[model samples]
Target chain A: MITIELNGQQQPLPTGSTVSDLLSTIGSDGKSVAVLVNQQIIRPENRPTLMLQEGDQVELLIFAGGG
Target chain B: MDLLQLGSHSFSSRLILGTGKFSNAAVMLQAVRASGAQLVTVALRRFNREQAEDDLFGPLSTIEGVTLMPNTSGASTAAEAVRAAHISRELSGSAFIKVEIHPNPQHLMPDPIETFEAARILAKEGFLVMPYITADPVLAKRLEEVGCAAVMPLGSAIGSGQGLANAAMIELIIRESSIPVIVDAGLRSPSEAAHAMEMGCGAVLVNSAVAVAGNPPEMAEAFAEAVAAGRKAFRAGLMQKSGSAIATSPLTAFLGATL
Candidate 1:
């Protein structure tokens, strides 16, 4: 298992978990969410190819109400 | 048609709606529809499974003619805002980004320096940057010079509903700015929106005024009408004010005994 930071919180994932796998584990279908790894956007097509390693900084953002 | 032109995009409604402070998504959507706002503002928040309903992109997308203008509200610095803009562009596929960098939440006053930096960079990156700033004419002009799509000066503090406390400065901005001057905050009623438009603002953004009203949808409709009326009134030309009253009828001898 490898530990990665998800939205500022530590989360444990299996070894070599891809971005898609992480989203699936979190019960998100990867819709309407922006995934960033190390401050770089991981596009939808690349989510399956991008592998998560230990200490990877991951952030998933969605649009919320604002003025 | 008299469209509010921002960058290369045109919008029929001058009343830009904010998606915050609503009781729920349903009512928010109702207000969005009733407001007829083609451009709406939203923020980037961390996705939590427990609060999946907080995500507004899907629901707002369903509303036709609604374009997302994601704001960099949570960012305290230029770097953070720039990063958020990039991510938001990736998500929304829209070039519009509202550069709102208020470091201290107490007053919610945008940091002019950071906002200008973010707007300059974002505009150069080919994004239509609409910067929310204080009602400072100098700053507004500077942002315009940096290629911003529009300058959104606060009517007062964010969410305060003070109703154009900074009207004087805002008017100065409108007079000097070549780009759209949008009053983006602190509006309480439809009249205030109309007043802003009458004062020559290109657009007005409202959130708390509609979201907290007794009937949000009705209030939204009222604001939309007021904005249109004010814009029309402005286009038709407003009469100048005078210190003394001027007689409408010929003060001629019609009422007098002598011709």
Candidate 2:
């Protein structure tokens, strides 16, 4: 199992899951958003294929029209 | 020149100036006037309560008809950015915001996740969100889809004066984006600003470049001229590139053969 932090909350994911897998499991809405793994921005193309490691911290930010 | 429409505000000048790093308020005001920039960026922070008079706000407040774009310069989190935006609204009475979330002070690189998160919240709250981000095409599209007035992508690291480090990415952003793409940060000279405009950017935000110059007013005028020239060039349409060099000599000439 791998531990990840989403917006500061720690959660566990299935072992050997990638960031894409984790995003899918969490049911992201696919809006205009950015993902950071261990404080480094993960490019969109690499998001789906990049594998996750144990104790990895992930933060996903969604940019939406607010005003 | 096409007016830059940010939220409800429309500005004719594409050069956005920042109110920082100036030697004094007079110089700042003079520089701003010379630049002909309608939108000016100001940082939101606590003023020294002990001081009898704060000079920073006075000079900025006196500038007539210029829209004050308050930035969350020190904020590192979404919540902080949001709070800073609100404070700016109260202080300036304008919904215009430059959402900046830089957790790392050393490089001042924006935290993309935090910036996006803050942008979403701020936009939802009815603030004109203009995020300063890295030259990431995906991020630019994401920001646009979320209702940002414009996306301000940096030419290089903030204050580094490293001009247009991510040229390809910036070009991609300009090509794909429907809204304005303002090249912001790391611009050290008027030429850099002009280059950004020539690359089809809607505008360029400059601060350190003008402020740090030996003569701020002269530098500001130079930038204004450069921006104008660049915009004119862009509107005039740049020449198309050719992949391979073409020979002037025709095939018939070669066949007729003079050696």
For DockQ, the strongest prediction is 1
Off by over 4 Å in 1: B250-259
Q: How high is the lDDT of residue B167 in model 1?
A: 93
Docking quality level of the chain pair in candidate 1:
high
Look at candidate 1 and give me any clashing residue pairs: none
When summed lDDT is taken over every stretch of 10 residues in candidate 2 chain B, the lowest stretch is: B46-55
DockQ of each model against the real complex?
A: 0.92, 0.01
Q: What is the lDDT of residue B67 in candidate 1?
A: 98
Choose the strongest candidate by TM-score: 1
Query: What's the CA RMSD of model 2 in angstroms?
Result: 16.8
True contacts kept of 2: 0.00
Clashes of each: 0, 5
Q: Would you list the clashing residue pairs of candidate 2?
A: A65-B146, A66-B123, A66-B124, A67-B123, A67-B126
